[model samples]
Target: MAGILSLVWFVGSVLITPFLMILLCIVFLASIGKSLGVRRLYVKLLLIIFEFGRANIETAQKGSNAEDTSEEDEEHIEEISPLNSNATNDIKHLKTPNGLKKPNNGYVPNGNSVISRDDKLILVPEPPFTMHKTDETTDLSEAKDKCKDYDLCNIFDYLKAGMESIIEDQVTSRFEAEELKNWNLLIRTNRRYEFISWKLTVMWVCGFFVRYFFLFPLRVTICFFGVWWLTLCTALVGYVKEGDFKQKLNKYVSVMCFGILSNAISSVITYHNEENKPKSGICVANHTSPIDVLILMCDNCYSLIGQSHGGFLGILQRALARASPHIWFERSEVRDRHAVANKLKEHVSNPKNPPILIFPEGTCINNTSVMQFKKGSFEVGSVIYPVAIKYDPRFGDAFWNSSKYSMMQYLYMMMTSWAIVCDVWYLPPMQQNEGESAIDFANRVKSVIAKQGGLVDLVWDGQLKRTKPKKEWRERQQEEFSKRLKVE
Candidate 1:
């Protein structure tokens, strides 16, 4: 019994001592808001492994293709006969670049169709086919006269475009995960290259164990302790008198607490143009994930505005509200735009309070593009500070698809991924021009962000992820079709 007890005690020490040490180190670094350069080093190591894996995948694919070519040749010889020459020609004529035979309808295959990385057919419509329309319209008889002159071939363009949209749409793809140019060895990523080589397989197995078993536990420990620390610290800070000292303490506490939490994902953020950081105005940014709040909070404190949520998000929201002037509206209250605007105006009127951080896009995008920004925030008439955040997909996917995954599941994926790497840029402050509409102002800000971040500027609303396209949009498309038939 004595020998068994000694062995058990020794094993426990061996397992627990390193974990305790790591915890202490993380806490110390988080408190000081410093890093030991380990994250960048780890990223660099990953790039090397990824390069090796890519080489192996290429080599393996070449060998496999050679074997497949021989087998295909033998099968082709057996399947064909001298009398089937015309059938073979017919087959070749039907073949498309996508490797699928086109339907036997009158629609001719067009060059405008592109095959995206995910094997989806992307139809690049002609610019004149856009939904935007002018005020000019012709009389019914005049339109009829033009329709008589319309070329029959033009109708095929519409048919092809419609079919391509049915296969895959431009808007829906933005809500999905962004594809990576090279595989990063994460199973969750879009590519599956781990099985191509034994070296990659071994490396992937080790990485899986490290991420799920070691990194995940460590991250959860840091996050759990960090949450409690934030609650306690905020509670203590709330007791301080309302003055500059309190403000300074609040900022310090927010940065330190959020810094600790961000450490949970081993986040590596690079901020540019710090001089343009928001001081006393409405701060807007493109949303990719809930981590955007944590990322920005680590650098500077901002009064957040969002609808109230429950569960883990709720705990964080309640904790934050304790120390800062955050606005969390109930679901019903959110629909009252006037009330929300009044609150926003009141908050911005106070010079001492931090600038209210708002994500005007209103939903998380896949980080490849900036969707339409809601005009409500721009209508406030305050100096708008635009922020752009772009994540490196080669590291990990940062987009959150709420419809498909719950908050806890999303967090689990995040915690188990390699790391979160992103860049934040603070562009120059913008204001709505005189006589300019709110929508135009919002579009102007969105364009600036999309340009700076090298993201595609999309005019589509982000809310379309949860809702169908408005009925009027379909009607407008019909109107455009009628106009297309009009020769002028």
Candidate 2:
């Protein structure tokens, strides 16, 4: 019994000593915002794996195609009729993927028309109204002239437009996960290429074990450590008197804490235009994931405003509030727009406070587009510092689909992902122009962010992800349709 106890103690010390050393190393390196180039090397290895997977997938596809050459040719011939061939050519001309055509003359729906699409019900306007908007509106007189006769042929264009939308929708897809161009060896992605070859299959199996059994446990430990560190450190800082020293200490602690959290997902962020970083004002960015807060906080400390959450998020929020003034409104308090605005105004008014980060979209987009920006932040009348964050989907999908996944589930996916790679661009500060309405200013800012992030600039509200279209929008569409039906 004595010998067994001795062996057990010896084994335990041997296992724990290295772990403790690693833990200390990570904490020290993360506190100073320095890495040992390990993450970059890991990323390079992932790229090599992806390249191997792509080559294997291509080879498998070529082999299968060679076996079914005659059948493939027949299917191709049947799929591409003269009309569809012309459409395909036009789609190619527009450089659209997945047979999606965004012609110079295609208009996205804006509460104007009701052409429904596939398994899902999405309404769009018929052409020439479908034409893309410009400084000058395209002459719809010819379209009106054809509609004047009220012939069956006139309705065919609507059917055609409806069918096109069904095949390749431009709107609803934005709320869903962004489709990958190539498989990233992750099962969650829409693309699956794991079965392409035996070697590829072996690699995927190994990757699964590595991610789930090895990486997941390590990441969870790091994340929990970060949370505890943040909670305890902020609690201590909360006792400090309100002064420059307290503020500086809080900022340093916050950065280090968030930096540790970032390492949990192996995030590799590339920040641009650091010179434009906001000192003290409203910082607006497109929302893609809750980690947007974590990502931003890692670089610079900011006072965050959001609806109060429970569980893990609640703990962090409470900790942050204790250290600094982060405005976390209860669900009931959120509906009081004026009260919320007042709180924001109060926070921004103080010169000593750090910049307040706000996501004006109000919900997460799929990282493919910038949706409508809520104008409340713009109405604050503060200088707007636009920060554009674009994530590389090849590394990991940073978008949080709140409707599908819970917060914990989303975090699990993020942990198992290869890495969270993103670029953050801090744009020049903007102010609402004299006489410019808040909505217009919001849109202008949204456009700048969309352009900077290489995302589609959309006018649709992201809240439409779960909610129905507004009654006012439906009424506007009806009004426009009634006017179109009447003789002008």
Candidate 3:
């Protein structure tokens, strides 16, 4: 019986202890929650008090604007504080950052600075210290009488006393500052987290599609959809990423259509040697917009060599590796210049992908003027085809907004615009000679385009300029030649 009782007691203690511990934990969490709630309430109350006090002070100042100075004097006395003359000299000697003298005179010294009988310097501790205007206007007897009553100076004293009170109130309300700091930090953290989440989601979704669906049949189908689908996809992505699709689309469509139209027009309008046909060469053009890619891709046989921005985009490029033959470049791959050059060389060498499209301008520029071309594309063994595209007068104003206009608004502007026009001039292809440098070749091509396309001023040679031949000289020369022939 004793053993059973002991065992029962032990069991009861073990079970009850855990329940009590859990209850204690519950109480601790509840207490913490209550404390935070009280702190939040306190901060809100303090803000309300500060706002109310500030408003009341402003209202009081306004109300006293019409009050008579004499009555104010009757209410309070003015205390005259002596200024130290030496302190004033010290302040005047102070220098500014630019080695200039201090603007305001320094504090008074020796407490010997005399106060005028009418003009009393009263120090009011409130913001924008107050000054009472007094002169011959106040009766001497009345001024002396008012100066004796300290209560007459109560207005200035009240202003001083209220200032200290306001400062103390502000100190008590510091919880508001803490709350605002915490709120801002929370918002910033949330925004960062949201962006990270969005990037992760995009990666996952894009990866899943490329890995599973973007295989043989699907890839072929995507290719067949042609420029329109590519444009739509690119526009959709730009819209999602930037929240502006219309302007980007417009710029894209305009540049692309211009290229196509220019090519078609040139085919009919331009004359060329049919027998000594221009060999297939890499077309190097200025890259003003992403639509430039589609324009080049219009020739289905021509493959693209693009630098891939990693992750899902890179994976997508890899999946279409055979079809597109893109040069997959990591963002960090810029550190390895040789690797990039080698990749470019390999892609350009492929016989199947002749005439690689290269944007030698390096970056997008306004369509008005062409930037200097980068020389990397010229180094490729293939002949270089220089093409100059000029937009029609109407679409020349289409520049990407770096200021007030957002992407979406820009897109809308483009969609509303009518037809876009452009001129495409294809210069003759250039072959690399044994001793010719890339820079020399580039300059030579640039000169040809500038001359033939009216890009530079034309000058005529003196020998080519002819004046009308003298009729008498011509007749005399003919008669002499006939006499010489008779003698022979």
Candidate with top lDDT is 2
Give the winner by lDDT: 2 or 3.
Answer: 2
TM-score of each: 0.82, 0.84, 0.35
> For candidate 3, lDDT tens digit of each residue in 173-292?
211111111111112122231122344345435533532342222222223332233344444544343323543433343333333322211111222222322234576765445444
Q: Which parts of model 2 are misplaced by more than 4 Å?
A: 1-15, 69-165, 189-192, 485-488
- Please give the clash total of every predicted structure, in order: 0, 3, 22
lDDT of 2 by residue, 229-306 (tens): 999999999999999999999999999999888888999988999999988999999999999999899899999998
lDDT of model 1, residue 385? 95
Candidate 1 regions exceeding 4 Å error are 1-6, 67-160, 189-192, 482-488
lDDT of 1 by residue, 1-488 (tens): 99999999999898779878987887788778788988889888888987877777667766767565656655554464242454344333332111223322322122112322222222323424322234457245543454455677656656777775665455776887775445678864323567777888999999999999889988888889889999999999888899989888999999989988887898889999999999888999999999999989889989999899998889888888888899999999999999889999988888889999999989998888888898889888888999999888777788899999988889888999899999999999999999999999999999999999988787888898789989987786677566666655
Model 2: how large is the Cα RMSD against the reference? 5.8
TM-score of 3: 0.35
What is each predicted model's overall lDDT from 0 to 1? 0.78, 0.79, 0.40
Ranking by TM-score: 2, 1, 3
Which of the two candidates, 1 or 2, achieves a greater lDDT against the reference?
2
